[model samples]
Target chain A: QKEVEQDPGPLSVPEGAIVSLNCTYSNSAFQYFMWYRQYSRKGPELLMYTYSSGNKEDGRFTAQVDKSSKYISLFIRDSQPSDSATYLCAMRRSNFGNEKLTFGTGTRLTIIP
Target chain B: EPEVTQTPSHQVTQMGQEVILRCVPISNHLYFYWYRQILGQKVEFLVSFYNNEISEKSEIFDDQFSVERPDGSNFTLKIRSTKLEDSAMYFCASSEVDSLRPGELFFGEGSRLTVL
Candidate 1:
């Protein structure tokens, strides 16, 4: 099984709709979680990240982590057409040099006008 | 803001030829990294560098690959011999500190490598 799993979604929704993107991991050792936004032909840009099992809110985005279940999520409120891009979930253990950070396949989201 | 920058936005090379992809990370950053994304695929970690040494490397970063901090401002990834499967978009990134921010990793626009 892969260390991290995310549904590669071509999820389309109307503007102002609430969007929920999620990721699940099998490793109990993963203590940090992050979400990234990647536009076509561009690099992944960090959206937000949470330290552990908790919720973090930044602007219109919210990141939630449930370490007990090895699950994490990013919620977007009042989604905009500009939000159309690939959402990727990434995480790693506390030790920086022990291993390279792992990433999910990413979910493609498109907000329709 | 100061973001990472990479050279040769697009490169096409013959198989078995040596290729060096270059990057200039954020000037004040303490950590540097290399990542690649094959078309239609997620970005994958290649190697991480800190304090002039490789801190971590992925399995995909094999014997054919090497990294160097040849100058104060530049970090580079060199492939000894190119292979067709080596074609991908190579991105250079850096962080101001040592943490999970490789996610927020200030990435260059990326160099598209085409091996033929």
Candidate 2:
């Protein structure tokens, strides 16, 4: 089974709506979860980060992780046109030396104005 | 507001030829990493470097692939012999602390490699 699974969504939503993105993982060792935003032909930019299970909020973006279910989520409130991009869910173990991130397939989002 | 930077935004190289992608990670960051992404796939880890040595690598990072921190500021990934499957976008990233800390990693714009 793949380590991380995410819906490759070309999800479209109206502006000012609430957008939800989710991911599931098979690895129980993952202790760090993150959300990244990628523009067309650009690199992945860090959006939200959460440690283990719980929630983290940053302005309009919120990230939640549930270790027991191996599920993680990102919620965007008052979504704007500028928020249109591919959202990637990434995670990694708690190793101190080599902490390479494992990423999801990414979901493409579009905010219709 | 420092960020990682990669060279040769896009490169088209002939198969079997050698190619080198360079990156300048954020200053003061001690951990560095290389990741790859195909046209429609997820980002995969290639290798990680720390203290001028390779800390870890993925199975895809075989003998054909090698990483070198040639100097103080430059970290490079060299493909000794390129293959068609090697065509992908390579990203360089760096973080101030390890995963134990809350510090987030910063990524470069990425270098697109096209092997024909």
Candidate 3:
């Protein structure tokens, strides 16, 4: 099994709808969780970040990590068409200085107008 | 805002030919990395460099691959001989701190490699 697993979704939602994206990880040591949004032909842009099993909110985005299940999720509130992009879940073990980040296959999301 | 920039946005090479992909990371960043994504696949980490040396590398980063910070600002990934499987979108990333907390990384747009 892959260290990190995410559904390759072309999830379509209406504007102003709430969207939830998730990823499951098998690496018990992953302590840092992040969500990145990638537009077509562009690099992944950091959207949400959490250090442990908890929630962090920024603007319309929220990131939650459940260490017990090794599951992480990204919730988008009041979604907009501009939010259409691929969302990537990435994680890494803490303080392993210079350890590379492991990324899951991104989920493509489309916000319809 | 400063961003990671890469050169030769697209490259086409023949199998067995050497190719060097170049990147200039954020000036304040100290940690550098190379990651690749084959068509319709997950992004895979290749190697990480810090303090002018490779700190870690995945098994996929075999002897055929090497990295160098030939200058103060330029970080390059060189493939000794390209293979058919090496055709992918190569991304360069960097972090300002060594700590993995929150895992903040800045990535380049990416260089697409097509091996013929």
Candidate 4:
């Protein structure tokens, strides 16, 4: 099994709809969780970050990590067409400079007008 | 705001040829990394560079791959011989510190390499 698993979603929703994206990991060692948004032909851009387990809110975006369940989520409120992109979940076990990140396949989301 | 920058927005190379992808990491940042994404695959880590040497590399980063900080401002990933599988979008990222304290990475626009 892959270290991280995310539903490769082509989920489409209307503007203003709430969107929930999630990922599950089998590695109990992963302590740092992050969400990245990637636009077509562009690199992944950091959107939200969380340490260990807890919920973090940033304006219209909220990131929730449940270490006990080995699950992480990103909730988007008042989603807009501009929010269309690929959402990727990534995690790492250490703060060490050489630590490599494990990433999920990513979910493709689209907010329709 | 300062950000990472990559050269040659796109590259088309023939199989078996050497290709060097260049990146200028954000100044003042100490950690640099290379990642590649196949057309429909997840971003895969290639290698991480710190203190003028490779800190870690993924299994995908084999003997045919190399990284160098030939200058103070540039970090490069060189593929000894390209294969069709090498076609992908290559990204360079850097962080002020490692993955601690919300260590955020700034990624370059990416270099699209098409190996034919």
For model 2, the stretches where C-alpha displacement exceeds 4 angstroms are B98-103
Model 1: per-residue lDDT, tens digit, A1-113? 98999999889999999999999999988887889898987878888978857899999999999998899999999999999999999888864543456889899999999
Worst 10 residues of 1 chain B by lDDT: B96-105
| Ten contiguous residues with the weakest lDDT in model 3 chain B | B96-105
Per-residue alpha-carbon lDDT of model 1 for B4-60, expressed as tens digits? 889989999999999999999989887889989888787899998888889889999
Query: In DockQ, how does model 3 score against the reference complex?
Result: 0.73
Global lDDT for candidate 1? 0.88
Docking class of 3: medium
Residue by residue across A27-111, what tens digits does model 3's lDDT show? 8989888899999888888888898688889999999999999999999999999999999999988755677889999999999
Q: How many backbone collisions does model 3 have?
A: 0
Docking class of 2: medium
TM-score on 0 to 1 scale for chain A of candidate 4: 0.97
* Superior by lDDT: candidate 1 or candidate 4: 4
TM-score of chain B of each: 0.95, 0.94, 0.96, 0.95
Worst 10 residues of 2 chain A by lDDT: A91-100
Report the C-alpha lDDT of model 4 over A1-113, residue by residue, as the tens digit: 88999999889999999999999999998999999999987888999989858899999999999999999999999999999999999998966665777889999999999
Q: For model 4, how does the per-residue alpha-carbon lDDT over B1-116 read when each residue is reduced to its tens digit?
A: 99999988999999999999999999999899999998889999999889998988999999999999999999999999999999999999998774445446778999999999
lDDT of 1 at B69: 95
Q: Over 4 Å off in model 4, which ranges?
A: B98-103
Considering every candidate listed, which one attains the maximal lDDT? 3
Best by DockQ: 3
* Cα error, candidate 1, residue A20 (Å): 0.7
Candidate 4 DockQ score?
Answer: 0.68
- Report the Cα lDDT for residue A68, model 1: 89
